[model samples]
Target: MSALLQLSKLIDALSERIGRWASWLVLAAVLISAINAVVRKAFNVSSNAYLEIQWYLFAAMFLLAAGYTMLRQEHVKIDVILHRFTKRTQIKIEIFGIVAFLFPLVLVVIDLSWPLVVKAWLTGEMSSNAGGLIRWPVYAMLPIGFALLGLQGISELIKRVAFLKGLIDDPTEKKLAKTAEEELAEAIRAAAEGAKK
Candidate 1:
């Protein structure tokens, strides 16, 4: 029980950190794109460098945001049917789907991506695009993302196991799904802060 709580806390901290960093990356990408557009249109100066940077930034944002998205239970689910099931049934389904399907997929992604990243590193792979920015560093995000995802999946699986054992109550699905009110409130708060700044 204590171990599960400790792991949950760690995962939460990691998710928050990743989410913040991903947000910053996205903001940077937006700023860079805006600058590129202005420079090209106003100054008649374009940059292949800026275009390449956009793709790399987008790739990093996608990969780095994945684990945090999963942690928040924001991933799409076909829960139209699953929502009607009993708690015990839900647990069984999670054990089968997650243990048999989800975790294995994460492991396979991590396993395959590691070698791909290593080869990219060894060969010093670069974009074929002329005047492109650094590419090998972008390739490295694949393994790093999957590795973090795999770790978080393991942590979630352990928590599920503990729930099965009655060590902890399953986290309520209702609370997991944020209501529209919550979303609106968050948006309003953000807008207010932005206005102040």
Candidate 2:
């Protein structure tokens, strides 16, 4: 139990760092797209690299951010019916879902994607578009994304088990509301800081 908690913490910390980097990737992608549009419209010249860059950035952003999302418990759950259940029942369902569904799926994806990415790299796969930039890094995103997601799924399973064993209280009831409020406050603070700047 203690070992699982420690491993979960370490993974959470790593996910946080990855999530931050992913956020930067998203920001860079937006800026690049904007610049690309302007260049094409104003200067009547566009680089072939920008299209590939967008896909790479978007892929990295989604893949790297997945673990963070899982850690934050922000992933979608079809819980319209589950919400009416008792806490113990909810925990049981969660445990079942994690063990039976999530873990196996993640493991399969990570296992399959690893070889797929390696093959892409070995073959030097590129965009099918003629004279377009070939981005090998984007090919790497598949295994990396699923790998991080698998780590996160492990952490989540541990957490769910802990909750079921009565080691920790379940926070599902108010977790979303609290998270949303916190996010709103953060946005407000950022807006104020930008205004001051």
Clashes of 1: 0
Candidate 2's residue-wise lDDT over 68-93, tens digit each? 78777788899899989988898789
What is the Å distance of residue 175 in model 2 from its true position? 5.2
Measured by C-alpha RMSD in angstroms, how accurate is candidate 2? 3.6
Best by lDDT: 2
lDDT at 93, model 2? 90
Backbone clashes, each candidate: 0, 0
Candidate 2 backbone collisions, by pair: none
Residue 94 CA error for candidate 2 (Å)?
Answer: 1.2
lDDT comparing candidate 1 with the true structure: 0.74
Residue 42 of model 1 has an lDDT of 98
> TM-score for each prediction?
0.82, 0.83
State the lDDT of candidate 1 residue by residue for 1-197, as single tens digits: 78777887698679658865676676678889999999999999986889988888898888887777667666677878987998877777876876788778877877877787788779877777777765668877887777667666666676677787888777424345554346545756897899999
Cα RMSDs, all models = 3.8, 3.6
